[model samples]
Target: MNKIAIVYGSSTGATEAVAEKLQSALGDADLFNAESVNIDDLKPYDFLIFGASTTGIGDLQDDWEMLLPKMEKMDFSGKKVALFSLGDSASFSTSFAGAMYHLYKALKGKVEIVGSVSADGYNFDESDAIVDGHFVGLALDEDNEYNETDKRIAVWVENLKQYLN
Candidate 1:
């Protein structure tokens, strides 16, 4: 079985682009769009990577918002999940990648979510996604700092391999 499942919800394709890149970088994970994802599609993988874009004032994007209740109900006890968020840090510094906060909450005690990235390189003023001194997952400012995404993903994937293998 593949070790990871990279799922994403995107309104304007930014998050999907990141998902694609993550699959390319990892080279061995399954990618699923949030709109059509089902438990069966996820059952084979022990690791999951969820990606979504932050919407108005830090709200979760539509497809991911709709998927939350279902995700919360799943038995993810033995699974490890990660998150990647896409938001405009420059325009919404106060709420950069904040929607990831909800996703993290839904899976917190249920799943062993991994890949908490350090908050060091981000230029945002604040983020709901921040837990203590780190992001809940790999946070990406694709709308504002697109150039950094490649480096960020490469580093995150490298760190992620430690958990996967």
Candidate 2:
């Protein structure tokens, strides 16, 4: 029984969609809306998948903002964790990928870094996703610009699945 948690902060449902897809790929997973998540709930899961959307100039979306302060104060100790971020590269100069920065910083020592999903080509760190350069679900609008970036997200989740199994 590989218990995993998929927690996410999404404004327009984009990030949530990605999170759900990741969950499907990874097998059975507990899903949480960031606003309702308590850090204490993490106790049961062996692995965690944190998802967030970019908002207001590279800042984490509102839901994640509420959870971050609390999550930062807690300890993940023996947890295995990964991150996935959703954002439009054009809107924020720093981009949606920046959302993973803080969470990774806070949970670094407490958990093992398994993977990360970033539109701007983030190194997956301790995982094979980086070595394979596996990126799918990269959605784009009619103009060929990243309006959604879904393919890249799918690849990101699939890569993270490697860690879960």
TM-scores for all predictions: 0.96, 0.73
User: Model 1, range 36-148, lDDT digits (tens) per residue?
Assistant: 89867888788999989999898888999988888766877678888888889889999999888889988888888889999987898989999989999999987778899
Per residue, candidate 2 scores C-alpha lDDT tens digits across 65-84 of 88888876676766788776
Clashing pairs in 2: 136-151, 136-152, 137-150, 137-151, 137-152, 138-151, 138-152, 139-149, 139-150
TM-score of 2: 0.73
lDDT, residue 107, model 1? 82
The models' CA-based lDDT, in order, is 0.88, 0.62
Clashing residue pairs in candidate 1 are none
Q: Which whole-number lDDT from 0 to 100 does residue 114 have in model 2?
A: 73
Off by over 4 Å in 2: 117-154
Q: Which ten residues in a row have the lowest lDDT in candidate 1?
A: 70-79
